[model samples]
Target: MPTPIKMPALSPTMEEGTLARWLIKEGDTVSSGDIMAEIETDKATMEFEAVDEGTVLKIEVPDGTEGVKVGTVIALLGAEGEDAGTVDAAPAAAAAPESSESAQPAASEPPEPTPASAPTVAPAKAASSAGTRTIASPLARRIAEKKGVDLASVKGSGPNGRIVKADVEGAQSGSAVPRREAAGPATGQAAAAPAGPATLPDFGIPHEDEKLSNVRKVIARRLTESKQTVPHYYLTIDVRLDPLLKLRAELNAALEAQGVKLSVNDLLIKALAKALIQVPRCNVSFGGDVLRSFSRADISVAVAAPSGLITPIIVDAGSKSISTIATEMKELAGKAREGKLQPHEYQGGTASLSNLGMYGIKQFEAVINPPQGMIMAVGAGDKRPHVVDDALAIATVMSATGSFDHRAIDGADGAELMQAFKALVEAPLGLVA
Candidate 1:
């Protein structure tokens, strides 16, 4: 009897996810804690670790499969001294079948609903006059289509001469006859963005539909919900940034020995965290009739990654030193961009900060991340005429807008938080102290 490997719930909220890629294949030896695959959850792409040490006897779910439910057996592993090849798939039958609706495959393989069952078929004979369909992996067929390699012309080298990914990759790229579509578990390509009445009229213009990744999809859903359900009110403030900029440069020079550098956003994250501490009324989440106020300020700093917009939390930013915040934020941003952030690293926050100053956007209100009371939107810092010592003087200034959830925070409380933030940023010494 072989041990069944199930699809893991990568996050607390993940119900289903895409098995983006498989690192271990059939007949591969794996130890406990070894990364076996990458699962794209609702929040981020995370590596799935192996739980039991054994030889992978069968991979029920192939790579590139989408909408695989949690607890579905994805593979089977053989114990020590067991023949990996001769073992029956009886162990797999004990597991329930997958019922992922979004899975793409030919209509002929409809009886078995899951990806694990879709690819277990006989070898495909090259197409001639008989109309016998080809047997190829979903990924192989996608590659063939992209390279225009006729499946009928290529020889399959997989089990019983089944067409697999290697066969397609080794085949020469050229013009060929129509491809005989193979019935398989999942396509190699990302699911293309659904075309529908949901989209606008093309008006006969040429266009290509791109797929929305899991991250992008979640972002869209959450942001849309935030806007529609959350009663939001905006408050804007102009803060003098020259002192902060000067302090940053001085700090960087002094800390050059420690190799710590600070960005304007880093300072702002600290300011917002401290502001939340100063005005606890604004650092809260509205849960129906309940208002939950946080004792410590965890600031969610928005960072744009290749996947989409993600807010990595700087936990207790108000408590950590400036150098500590800079270091942690840099690390988090790097991990965020690479899609490697852990769940806790990106999940919860008391307040949020989004900086468009680096991009030179002057001012804009950001949507509040759900359950959080507010998000500070910071814009570009540029030299402007400002009052100094009761006289007009030139100073570097930046505009920041706070988008507050009116259900949780009153306008006055939100304004107080903003005022505190501005004073802290302008003063520049309270943050370090």
Candidate 2:
């Protein structure tokens, strides 16, 4: 028997991926656990392995195929003693009749009592009473969705009553399938405002359109949803970093012989983790009916990659020393830039930190990554005039803004967390302790 190899979900959130490459060719013998292909998920390109040992019979999906849905059969493998020819012919035989019927649609008897202008309530009701699932090809379903044609109202003409592309296209002109309505807003909520113009006038200027990568698509969708669904509030505070800067210099000098160095961001991550521990209310995720709070802080540090911005986490960062955090961050950041981070390396976090200090950003607010309660945006530390003990002084100051999900974190708790972070950074000893 020929076995189909379907695309595996690399991560819990993964719905579709790109078939980046095929490592095994037709007729190649593969063992269980052997690498078979590379799949590009929204976050990383991961190698896919074979689950059953067999000879590769066919590759159904070619490399570079984008938007391949999870569970899609990408290849076929033949069991022992199954000839390649026979294995290849098995799938073809199953689909051959369907293809012929689709190709010769005109030969079939015309649909009776065509409901070209009338509503298709009768056919829909009949389909529902039959209790048979609608069998539509992926392409057909996509086309039907775009044309707003209900598949239930249209009778399939292909083999085994399977719906194909021709069935959808032909039904559009012959049947009055009601268009699917956009889901209404929740009760008592106003409908979303109409979207703005989709494109701007070209004005005779030539331009190229590049397709968005999976990472970019996910980033755009998630950020948009976060901004729309999460009720957000921002709190900003300025911290004097001269003490921390001096401490970091001394620590680096002492640790130079041991090959350990730390960045301001590292200390910031430690401070944030400690502050979350101090202000537990801010370290919560909104779960609709319930709220989830963690005893230990896992901090997600944002790193910009070639494809998009990703947040890789440092688990239980509050318990780790600053030097350890710095070391782990360097490795994670390197992997992030190379798109090699695994699911666990970047998945869940209690809170997030995004530092744009290296770019010299004075201050900026970041969108909270749900179901996280807050995200702290760290700006650059620079010399600024300040009042110390009622006397004018120049100190190295940095602005940190915490964006909180108002549903999960109250304004007072958010402010408290921010104040705790500021105090820790200013004192510089709590982080070391």
Q: Candidate 1 at residue 427, lDDT?
A: 97
Best of the candidates, TM-score: 1
Prediction 1 global C-alpha lDDT: 0.80
The C-alpha TM-scores of every prediction are 0.79, 0.77
Candidate 2 lDDT tens digits, 1-433 = 6887877888877766788889989889999999999889989888898999989877766557565666666677889898667753574533321121232222123322322433222112123447765765554655565555677777776434656567778876424333333333366433232221224456777876565789997887778778988999999999999999999999999889988899999999999999999999998999787899999999999999998999999999999998899899999999999888999999999999999999999999999898999999999999999887799899889999999999999999999999999999999898887
lDDT of 1 at 93: 59
Return the clash pairs for model 2, or none. none
- Residue 143 lDDT in candidate 2: 57
lDDT at position 348, candidate 1: 89
> Counting only residues 3 or more apart in sequence or on different chains, how many pairs clash (N, Cα, C under 3 Å) in candidate 2?
0
* Deviation (Å) of 244 in candidate 1: 0.8
